[model samples]
Target: MTQPNTQIPDFQSIMLPMLNLLESGEVFTLNQVVTKLAEHFHLSKEDLKIKVPSGQMGLFRNRVGWTRSYLKKAGLIHYPERAKYQITPFGKDYLKGKPKDLRIKHLKKMPDYIEWTKTFNQDTNNKQEAEITKEIESQTPEEVLASTVDQLNKQLATDLLDKLKENSFGYFENFVIELLQKMGYGEFREDAAERTGQTGDNGIDGIISQDRLGLENVYIQAKRFRDGHVGSPDIRNFIGSLALQGVNKGVFLTTSRFSESAIKTASDSKQQKIILIDGKQLANLAIEYNLGVQVDKTIAIKKIDLDYFEE
Candidate 1:
C-alpha cells in the first residue's frame, strides 16, 4: 500500500513466503494467493503498478505465478482443483524446518525437479554463463523466455546484415524495393516498383508507388556501406533529388547506420516526409515481415484450461 520506489522481489524470493501461505493445506485460488503475497511483502503501489515488458500482466503477479509453478514442480504444492492450490505433505514438512528461503537451488535437489529440468538443454558450454545465471536467478519465467528470444533475434540481425553487405548494390536496391512492397507500402503491386540501375538516374536508387493506382510515389535511396555512417551531405543530395522529382515522401534505407547530422538533416527537411531505416532496423523488419528469414520453429507455452475443469 505504500508508494515507495522499490524493486519487486524475484520469483525465488517469493517462493518461501508463497509456500508458507499454503502450509495450512487449505485451497486458495491463484488471485487470492497473489493478493496475500503482495500484502506479506508490503509491495508499494508503484511496485504493484509495474508490469512485465510485454505489459500484459503485473510484474509482481507474474513472479508469484512462476513461484507457484516452481513450487508445484518441486513437489511442494499441487492444484486441488481448477485455479485452486494447496501445499502438499512434502511442502508442509519442508516448512516445519523453518527454512529461510526457498530457491531454485533448493528445488534442484528434489528428484521431481531434477527430472523436470532434464528437458532443458544441459549443455554447459555457454560463454555467457555468469550473465545467464544472474538472469535465471532474478528473471521470471516469462522474462527469461522473452530475453532468450530477443538475444536470438539480435544475433540473427547481425548475421543478416553481414550477408546483406556481401551482395551487390544493385541487389541491395532491389531487395529494399521488395521489402517496402512486402510491408504494404506499394499495395504489393508487381509493376509498382523499379530500381534505377544507373548513376544517371540521380541520387534515387529506386521508386515505388504509394498506392495501386500510382497517384502518389515513394523515392528510395539504398546505401550498402561496408562500414562507416552515411553523413549529412548524402542525405542533402537525396533530399535535393526528391525535390527535383517533386516527391514529398521518401525512404532512405541503408545497410549501415546514419550519422547524427544525417538524421538531423532528414528531420529538418521542410518539404518532405523522410524515414531513415538503418541496418539493424532493416534486418528486424525483414525478420518481422518474413522477407529473407524463414520460421525455424515455433514453441507453444500453455497453461491450465480452467474452463475445462469447471464442471
Candidate 2:
C-alpha cells in the first residue's frame, strides 16, 4: 500500500501541476484545480483538510488560491469569468519545456511575471532583490498576498482619511449616509439615510432607519477629526444625547481613534449600546462597501471535474 504523502506542497511546488492541469485550455473552476492537485500529490484526506494559521479555511485550499494567484500573476492563467480560469497560449508554450517545477527564480525569467511582481507590490518602488524574492518564496502564497493586501489597505485608508478631512461637514454627512446604505442599513434603500448633521442637533449627525417600516432608529454621531482622538468626554456626551432623545443605540464614528477611557465608557454602558468606529475601521468599511472604490481586476481559481471519475 502506498502511504499517503504527509507533506503539504507549498504554493510554488503546486504551481507547475496547476499550470499542467489547466494546459488543456479548458475552463476549470478553482475547486476542480484543487482536487486535481490533491490527487496528483496523493494527499490524504487528513492532508487535504489541514487548516491555515488563521484556521478560517483549509490550508490546502489556501495554497490552491495562492498557486492560482501566482500563476495569474505570471500570466500563465487568465480568468474567463468570475469563477472560471483557463491557461493562455504563453502558458501552453512555457509547458513545452516540461520544467519539473516552478519557482520564484524561474518566474523572474519571465517579463510578465516580473512585471506582475511589481504590480502586486504597488507601493514598493524599488525592484525586488534576490533576497526579498527568496524570502517571499519561503512563505505560503496566501500569507504574502494577505500581508500585501493589508499594507495596501492601510495606505489607502490613510489617503482616504486625508481626503475626508478636506471635505466639508455636509459632505461628510452625506458620505456617512450613503455608506450606511451600502452596509445594508435601511434595507439598502436610497431613502434609508437622513442627514441631520445640522446645528442644535445635540451632537447627533444623522439617523438611520433600521427597518423599512421605520420601527427603530440608529443615531449617528459623525465626527470629522484630523489628529485629535475622540476622548471619553465625547463618548459620554453622545451617550447623554442618546439618553435625552430616548434612544438606546448610537454609533459614534470619528476619523480618529478612541482613547482607552472612551472605549471603556462605551463598553461599560449597561443600558446603552454604543458602537465605536474609529478612523481605520471607517476607512476599511468604505473600502468594503465600495463607496469610492472600484474593482481593479479579478482572478479565478480552477479545479478538476469530480463526475469524470464517478463512473
Best by lDDT: 1
TM-score of every prediction relative to native:
0.58, 0.54
C-alpha RMSD values across all candidates = 19.5, 15.7
Worst 10-residue lDDT window, candidate 1:
118-127
Please write out the lDDT profile of model 1 over residues 1-311, one tens digit for every residue. Answer: 33323468888899999998988899999889988998999887678888876566788887887787778767799776767899999989899999987787778877655543432212223335477687688988899889889856865675576568777988899889889988987765678998885869988998898877888999999999866668999999999999999999999998777878999999999999899998778988999998888987677889999999997
Reference-based lDDT, each prediction: 0.81, 0.79
Model 1: clashing residue pairs?
Answer: none
Off by over 4 Å in 2: 1-137, 301-311
Candidate 2 lDDT by residue in tens digits, 145-234: 788778657656655765786789888888877888788888656677788877799889999999887779999998888555789999
Q: What TM-score would candidate 2 get against the native?
A: 0.54
